[model samples]
Every structure is written in C-alpha cells, then in structure tokens.
Target: MEPVARAFAHVANMLFPRGCVGCDRPDAVLCPECHALFNGCLAQTLGTAEMGRWFACGWYRGAVRQAILSWKDHGDEECDRPFSEVLCSLAEQAGLPDHLGNVSREQVLIVPAPSSLASMRQRGRRHMMPLATGLASYLCARTGMHVRACEALENRGTAGRSVETGGTVQRSQRLKGRITTRGKILLKNKAVILVDDIVTSGTTMRRCVDVLSSQGAEVVTVLSLAHTPAGKPTKAGRHFSSEI
Candidate 1:
C-alpha cells in the first residue's frame, strides 16, 4: 500500500509540479529570483577551525531561510539541484579547486556535518548527504580529482531535543562529546571538506573540526548553504548584513 501510494504520488507530482521552495511560485524548485537569494559567497570566521574560518552561500534570513526550511524539514528534495549549484559556485568563489592538490593522486573527502539520529528519523533522511554528494561530483569533474563524499561523522542522537532553540551555552553543552567518528575511518593525512546546512555560533562545526583534527585530517575548509547573521556589529566586530 505504501509503494502504491508513493507511485501515485510520484505521478501526481509529474502532473502538478510544486511551487518554488522560496516563493511558492508554481512548477519550480526555486524560481530564478528565489535562487538568486543564495548567490553570494559570505565568509565567517570560526575561531577554532583549522583555517580559522568557513564560508556560507548566504545569510540565514528572509527568503534564503524560508527556502532552506522547506527543503530541510518539509522534504522538498527538488531544491537539491539549485542548492548544489550554490555550493559549487561557492567552491569556485572560495578558490577550492586550486587548493585541491595533485588532482590525479589526491582523493579528497567531502563530509557532511552530522545530523542527530532523531532528526534523521523525523526527516526520514540525512538531508545534507545530497549536497555533500553533489559537491563531491562537482569537484571531481572540475578539478579532475578523486572526490568522494564520506559519512565519517555521526551524532549519537543526544541532540534530538529542543537544541536548536537553546542559547549558545546550552547548545554547546548539548553537543559536546556527542559527535563521534564512524568506525575505522583512515582520515590520517586525508583532506576533508566539511559541509553543513546552516551554522550558528559555530558550536557544531567546531566540534566536527576537533574530531577530524584529532584523526590528523586536514580540513581544507568548511562550507554551508547559509549561516545565521552575525550579532552586534559594534561588539562582535563581524556582523554581516542580511543582504547579498
């Protein structure tokens, strides 16, 4: 019965394509204007990361946030293409191609930031896997390097609660020691590119970096679809406006 329903649902979607994730305009995953929202390369500093920074495609607000929420929580798988394109463009803007060395011999690993098991269960998938896989393929084609997406990180489900709504300290504490590497990954001396959907306060990204660094993995840089806007420009000294 489930398969029958899915088949009919698939046919129905073919006949009546859904609206864009950003604007709800008909028959598109992300209409041109909505896709445009994610066009810029915004870099933010992560004090603990290997490179001392990371990059995001855009700020997490307005249409960009709306589109991401739809795709991530509401299961709009169609947005994968446009979002993947965003990351690829970001890679170019961030000079990742040149940074990837010895194209023929180096096999870089694209690892998605871990999603808690509970979130995976709720979403029925590891949402970031598609973006990571897409980035891997793009890098391979563009640089002629062997890029593979590796799920070497996993969240042991300790953060299935209301972690997202918590304050910085609360969020950081909940995530501490919860992110662990998967079984027997030979990450020593490997080049890893960490990908995440959204980054706020850099807690999770920092932890992932710590784990990867512990294994002697050189994380080239971190990339995200979007990141929460920096706070208090006068104080934090790094507030990025929500604009492009």
Candidate 2:
C-alpha cells in the first residue's frame, strides 16, 4: 500500500478494531496459532483426475473454518495475504518445486475454481482469483516458469444450494454440466494448478477436473485453502482421503 493509503487503512483499523479473523486476537488478521493449522498440506486422492491427487491447506473446522468463512464470504479481504502465504507454504510442503523440476514447460497456469454467477455477485468478486494470482506469482519466483493465472472456468448458476452448503449426493448430481470452460484460450496441453477456497464433498472439485480435462489441460493437482474433513487423519496429523 502507498503511504497515504497505508495511513488510511491504519486509521480505519484503529477505529474499527476487527481483530483476528479466526480467534479475534487484537490487531491480527490471522493469529500465528490459527495460521499453524494451515501448514499441513493435507493430501487427498481424486480418482478421476489425471494427477490422481489433490491437497488442502487445512481441515474446514474450528479456527480454520472461521478464518476461511470470514475471508471468503464476510469480506475480510485482508486475510488474502495470510491465506495466500499459507497456500505458498502448502506448495512448498507438497514438493511442488521438486515436481516442477521434472516438467519442461514454457508456461504453467494457475486456474481458480469457478463460482456461480449468483455466488460471485454475492461475494462482489470471484473469491479465489486473488489466491490464484498469488500462487502463480509465487510459482514464477520459485520455479522460474512463465506462470499465468487465468479464469478458465465458469459455473452456470445451480438450482439448489452448493455441495458445500448442502453436502448431499443429490447436490453433487446437480453439478453435472454446471461447470464449463469460458476463456478464449482453450488451455490445451498446458499445465494447470487448480485453486479453490474450500473443498467440501469433492463433487465440485471433481466436476472442475472433468471440465479442464475435456479441454485437454494437464491438471497438475488441485489446491484448496481448506477442505471438509472426510477421512482418517494420518499419523502425521494431516488430513488424508480415500478414493473419491
């Protein structure tokens, strides 16, 4: 932020005193203890995906849940930086640098998972785009790849609530044909790192993978800020999933 903008933000914060998004620690957007919850780089199996694996930064529970909900839906835009940093941390934890070492690509793409038109309007933006850009920037600096963040997918508004809010197989069924490609670029033959704020039933994530694959994009793996815990915790205390 510029000097004047920084001063204004500081003043606004002092007056409002929003505190931490997770635990409400004074002056902290995400307290260190809350941030620690996101460092696991939890892994899950996505059977339909080419990469066959995806990762989440934390489980969608407790303080992690509070932080994500505040940032994603309640307009705690300041959390973007902390959350994005967590994602970069996750990339490093998940051996992304080592994986990219093997792929000789001219460019890599960071693709944000799509939201419905209604959801975007409600949130005033595509919530995950900032994270995608941040991850792409980090990947460029880390891997020396010409990385680009692109809004390559869109979800036509669904009839009922999302799988996350509804958490039903019926809601998952509604996801079919709901998500589709939207950009001028087909994303053909390019590497894609899928980004989302949360992964719930994995229904939406799988549908997105299907859409990207149909367009010939080589999806490296899915990455989300948090996920609804649906499997046994590994011995390391990280979230792990069975075949989805």
Which candidate comes out best when scored by lDDT?
2
lDDT of 2 by residue, 1-244 (tens): 3456557867888898878899999878998999999988778887664456799898889999889888877666798899899998988887776787777656688989888887777767677888888999998999888888999998995533353465557656677678889968767878888998888778888888888888888788899898886666654445455444
Give candidate 1's whole-model lDDT.
0.80
- Write model 1 residue lDDT over 39-133, tens digit each, in one string: 77777666655455688888788889899999888776777888999999888887788878543334689999999897887777788988999
Per-candidate TM-score against the hidden true structure: 0.87, 0.89
- The regions of model 2 sitting more than 4 angstroms off are 1-12, 48-51, 159-164, 236-241
lDDT at 132 for candidate 2? 89
Candidate 2 Cα deviation (angstroms), residue 112: 0.6
